[model samples]
Target: MNVDSPVFLFDQGIPGFENLRQFIFLEIEGNIPMRLMKSLEDQHISLLVVSPFFIYPEYEWELSEPVKQELLIKTEADVEVWSIVTLPAEPSQATLNLLAPLVLNRNEKVGKQLILHDSTYSSRAPLIRA
Candidate 1:
């Protein structure tokens, strides 16, 4: 991770967490693929996030033109995707919200949680393989 990683601005903020608009992605110590998305506005509002592709190799989606324009994404290389993970009381039950992925434009440092209108992905897809 870059020491000067830009703070991502979610203009409308994440759904259900509308109050949080700015966040920085922090790599969790000892967790290679997990990251802590810490909200700048609310210190306590941190989320565990990961690139869904790490667990689901086939994970893929086409960003709508509106989304691309909103994030100022000029090319495919400018996009980075991640999913919020829910850590259950039982660690093994941890799941990733694949239905609504966090799409960020690395170039603009802006992001949005895109909820698919219709998809096969689940909001609670298991983190680990069965």
Candidate 2:
């Protein structure tokens, strides 16, 4: 792990990979707006994520009180949201998982993948910037 990198703790880890806890957000070296969420415990566990608001300008979701308290989130500014990207053989065919967004508390350096039960958005939404 890079000493300079800020480690984000996921108390419950990701949905399927619940055992892995610690993660670090790495910026991709290029013009692409994507970020690499690398797991500290597993070298093979890295996810490509991007800000959902960049793709869907009007994208919005409500965080439950439990989630806010879990991450120690106090205000809207303390939160950051990211969507996992699924890239197919063709880059243009990539999709973003909007149904379950990764919500992070910037101040606390903790995060959780939140599943929106009442969301009309799809799990595989077209990755087109609006």
Candidate 3:
């Protein structure tokens, strides 16, 4: 990949798409908070992910030891967090998978989808707040 298209390596890949490991983020224009995470291994697989902080500033979670080591994350600055977004028929009905946030080690270009078992957050949290 070129400098403009740096790819993220998901060591174990995302949960359902385990076989596809490499991905690149395609930014969406026009003040959008979402991004298109396109798989390098498969052209057909693409996921819409959003920074949870943008939608919920209070959103927070701790990474397990295994996850931390796997990503080689050293500090908060070393990582970027994103949540999978699910768009429905209606724009307002879009939801984000808050229960499982995708964390990427920026310095290492490594990523992993982490499922929070102790959290109260839902897998499908509403995108638009009332």
Candidate 4:
């Protein structure tokens, strides 16, 4: 997992994470295996992540051309994605942060957290990110 000093956190350590300047990109350990992406801000910690196959089982992004270009991802193999989990006051109220998601281009080790302007989405949208 240390490809050219891979910046991924799953199989790597977050050296100097307390002072890390790159807030946009990261490496995280999803519920399953270690994926890629971590939160430097308050949105999330513990590096929550999800496999596209599990969470977004029915996801088909209508991403704009600009976003696709920004990710520098010309193909499906380059995409890596994740969402945040919200600990509920009680088990019945559990939720996930689906309004904003972290999308990354593993090929380049670059990432970005985007807020879905779509009002249909819930800030505490389920991890289903559906």
Best by TM-score: 1
The residue-by-residue lDDT of candidate 4 on 43-95, one tens digit each, is 45445455444655665456667877977879888877666556566755656
TM-score of each: 0.94, 0.93, 0.93, 0.60
- The TM-score of predicted model 2 comes to 0.93
**Runs with alpha carbons beyond 4 Å of true place in candidate 1:** 1-3
Residue-wise C-alpha lDDT for candidate 1, range 1-130, written one tens digit per residue: 4457579999999998998999999877885787888888887898999999999999987889999999999999999899999998999999999999999888899999999877999999999979
Candidate 3 C-alpha lDDT tens digits along 2-86:
3486799998889999999999988888898888999988989989999999989998877888888989988989989999999
- CA shift at 128, candidate 2, in angstroms? 2.6
Tell how far residue 111 is off in model 4, in angstroms.
Answer: 0.5
Residue 118 accuracy (lDDT) in model 4: 59
Query: lDDT per residue, candidate 2, 1-130, as tens digits?
Result: 4657889999999998999999998988888778899999999999999988887989987899988999999999999999999999999889999999999998899999989997899999999653
Give the C-alpha miss distance for residue 101 in model 1, angstroms. 0.4
Backbone clashes for every candidate come to: 0, 0, 0, 1
RMSD of each: 1.8, 1.5, 1.6, 6.9
lDDT of each: 0.91, 0.91, 0.90, 0.54
Itemize residue pairs with steric clashes in candidate 3: none
Choose 1 or 3, whichever is better by lDDT.
1
Worst lDDT run of 10 residues, candidate 3, spans: 1-10
> Which one wins by TM-score: 1 or 4?
1
